[model samples]
Target: MPLHLPHLRSVINSDGAAIFDAEQGTLTTLNATGAMLWRGIEQGHSKEQLLQSLADATQLPEEQLRLDIEEFLEQLTAQHLITSE
Candidate 1:
C-alpha cells in the first residue's frame, strides 16, 4: 500500500518538523529523525527503503528500526496524518 498525506501542511527545519492536519485541525511535532523519515515517506519511498535508509543513517540494527518504524506508522495512522491507498 502507498501512503498519502491528506489536507496536510508542514514545516521541516534542521531541528525538527511541525505538521498541521487541516482536516483534523491538529498539529503534530516530530524530532529530526522523525522529520527525515516523514520526508522519505512523503517522497514515496517504500517501507523497506525507509528501513534501510534509517538503518544506514543511524547505524542501528534493522530489526530494532523495523519495530520503531512500525510503531511510528501506527501512530501516524491513528492520528490520521497518513492514509494507505
Candidate 2:
C-alpha cells in the first residue's frame, strides 16, 4: 500500500519538522528523528527502501526500522496526513 495524503504538506527544517496549514493556522513540529525520517519519506522512498536507508543512515536494525516505519505511517494515516491503498 502507498501512504499518500491529499490534504497535507510537510517541510523539513534544521529543528525537526514543520507541518503547517495556511487556512488552519496550524504548525506542528516532530522530534529530530521524526523530522529526518519524514524528510526521507518525502524523498519518495519505498517502505523497504526507507528501512534500508534508516538502518544504514542511523546504524539501526532494519527490522526495528521497518516496524517503526509501519507505526509512523499508520500514525500519519490516523492523523489524516496519509491515505493508503
The TM-scores, one per candidate, come to 0.93, 0.76
| Number of the predicted model whose TM-score against the real structure is largest | 1
What is the Cα-based TM-score of model 1? Answer: 0.93
Q: On residues 1-85, what C-alpha lDDT tens digit does candidate 1 reach at each position? A: 3385758988898798999988789999999999988888888888898899899999998999999998988888998888777
How accurate locally is residue 18 in candidate 2, as Cα lDDT from 0 to 100? 74
Instruction: Report RMSD for candidate 1.
Output: 1.1
Candidate 2 segments whose C-alpha is farther than 4 A from its true place: 21-26
- Global lDDT of each model? 0.87, 0.71
Screening candidate 2 with a backbone cut-off below 3 angstroms (N, C-alpha, C), the clashing residue pairs are none
Error of 1 at 12 (Å): 0.9
